[model samples]
Target: MKILLVDDDPNILELVNIHLSQAGYEVIKATNGLEALAFLDEELPDLAVVDVMMPKMDGYTLTKRLRAEADIPVLLLTAKGELEDKEKGFLAGSDDYVVKPFEPKELLFRINAILRRYDKAVDTIIEVGPMKINRQSYEVSIGKKVLLPPLKEFELLSLLSSKPNHVFERDFLIERVWGYDYEGDEQTLNVHIKRLRDKLPEEVKIVTVRGVGYKLEVDAP
Candidate 1:
C-alpha cells in the first residue's frame, strides 16, 4: 500500500517516511499542504500520515482538503498533547491522532488498526429509510431495491449512511473512505455526495451542515 506523508520538518518527514517505507508501504513525501495537494493526483496512497504543525500551509488545512476529496485513512501527528487539540483533529477529519514525539511502534499500531478495520467495515449492510449500505461488500441499495454502487461509490455511501444523523465533517468522510486525510478542499465532498445522491431514494436526503460536515437523514423504511 502507498501512504502520503506531509510535514514541514525535514527530519520528521524523513524519519517517518523511512520507517513506514521500511514496513513495506510506498511513501510519498510533501513539505506543505500545497505540495501535498499536488502529490494527490500523481501519487494515490492507501493512507496518509500528517504533522499538525507546518510552514506555508498547516496540516489541519491540508487534512481538511484531502478529506473533501476521498475516503482515505488519516493518521495525525500532533505536537500538542492537549485533549482539545486531538478532539479538534477528529472534528477536522482524522481517523486517528497521535501526539508528536510518539513511539514509532505506537504509530504503526494506529495505522494498522485503521487498515485492519476492513473486516469491521464489511461485516454488515446498514439500512436507514430508503438508504441501504452493505458494509461487508461495500455495496449500497436504495429504497430496499438494488442500487448497485460503482467501485468508489460504495465507500462514499457507507461513510455517510453509517451515521444517520451525525454530521460527518467533510474531512472525516474523505479519510474514512479514501484512506487518507483531507487537504482543505470541501468541494471534493460535494462532488461525491452529489454522486451518492443520484442513487439514493428520492425520499432520503444528504444535507450539508453549512461550514461543518454532512448528514444523511432517512425515514421509516
Candidate 2:
C-alpha cells in the first residue's frame, strides 16, 4: 500500500518514512500541503498522514480537499491533544487523529485499523423500505431523490442498513466504522447519527436504543 506523508518537519517525514517503509508500505513524502496536492496530480495514494500545521496550506484544508476530490482516508497529526483540535480534525473528514510526541508503533496500529475498516466488504445495494443505499456509489436514493452524505455518515447509515432492525451496540459501531482505537467519545457517533437521520427519508428510521445503541427501522409497507 502507498501512504502519502505530509508534514513541514523534515525529521518527522524521515522518521515516519522509515517505519512505513520497513512495514512494507510505499511512502510518498511531501513537505507541505501544497506539495502534497501537487503529488496527487500524478497519482493518488492509498492513505494520507497529514500534520495539522503547515505552510501554504494547512492539514485541515488539505484533508477536506482530499475527501472532496479523492475520498482518501486521512490520519491527522496535531501537537495539541485538546478536544477542540481533535473535533476540528474529525469535522474536517479525517479518519483518525494522532497527537504529536506519539509513539510510531501506535501510529502504525491506528493506520492499520483505519485501513481495515475501509477494506470491509458490504453489499453493493441494500434496500430497506423506500430507501436504496448504494455502497459502491456512497449514495442513498429514496424513490427518485438521491442524497449524498459525508463519508462517516454514509458508513454509519450503510452499517445500520446492512442488518436492518438489528441493534448495533454503540461500542461496536464505533469500532467498526471508526478505528477500534478511536479517541473521540460517543458524541462523535451521536453527531454522525444525527446527520444521517436528518438526511434520510421518513420511511427510514435510525432509532436510539436508550442506553444500548442504535438501530435502523423501516416503516411497514
Candidate 3:
C-alpha cells in the first residue's frame, strides 16, 4: 500500500515516514498541500495522512480536492479534538481524524481499519447487465461510455450492485458509505440516491423498498 504524508513539521514527517515504511507501506512525504497535489499528477497513493493546519492550503480544502479529483481516502491530523473540528473534517470528506500527540501505533491501527473497510466493500470489478463498476479506478461504464459519479454516489451504487435485488436499509447504507460517525441525516442519502438514479443507465435500476430501503435491479441483457 502507498501513503501520502502531508505536514509542515519536518520532525513529524520523519517520524511518520519511519513508522509507515517499517509497516511495509511506501510513504510519499509532502511539506504542504500544494506539494501533495502536485504529487498526484505523477502517482496516486492509496491513502493520504494530512495535517489540519498547513501552509498554502489547509487539510480540509486539500481533502475536498482529493475527493473531487482522485477519490482518495484521507486521515486528518489536528491539534484540537473538539467535536466541531472532527465534524468539519468529515464534512470535507476525510475518512478518519486523529488529534495531535497521538500514538503512532494508534494511527497505524486507524489506517488499517479504514483500508479494511474499503477492501471488504469493493470487489475490484462488478458487472450487472450492461453496467460495469470498477472499484479500483472508481469508474462506472455502460456500453461504450464511462461515468464518474461523486465519491459517495459511486460507493452507494457499488454496494447496491454488489448484491443485485437485495434490499439494503437506508441506515445500513449510510453507515457503510459515510462511516458510522457520520452526522448527516437521511436526506443526504436521499440526495445521493437520486443523483445516482440520474447518472446511471436505464437498464440498471435502483428500486426503493418503500419503508425498508433500496436495491438495484438489472434488466436482462
* Model 2: per-residue Cα lDDT at residue 221: 73
Residues 1-221 of candidate 3 have per-residue lDDT tens digits of: 68999999999999999987766568999999999999999989989999999989999999999999889899998898999999999999999999999898788878877875777565789999889999888999998899988888988988788889988878667666776567878999999999999988888899999987999998887
Using all chains and alpha carbons, the TM-scores for the candidates as numbered come to: 0.55, 0.56, 0.57
Q: How close is candidate 3 to the true structure, as a TM-score?
A: 0.57
lDDT digits (tens) for residues 103-214 of candidate 2: 9878888887887667564357888998988888888898899998888888788878877888877876786677656799999999999888888888889999998899
The runs of at least 3 residues in candidate 1 whose Cα sits more than 4 Å from the true structure, single-residue gaps closed, are: 118-221
| Cα RMSD for candidates in order | 15.0, 12.3, 12.6
Please say which candidate is ahead in lDDT: 1 or 2: 2
Error of 3 at 25 (Å): 0.1
- Candidate 1 C-alpha lDDT tens digits along 1-221: 67898888899889998777655457888888888888877777777888888888777777788888756778889789898888888888888898878887678667867875753655486777755677665566655477667755676666666668877766546655554433557676677788888767777888888877788887664
* Candidates sorted on TM-score, descending: 3, 2, 1
Query: Which TM-score value belongs to model 1?
Result: 0.55
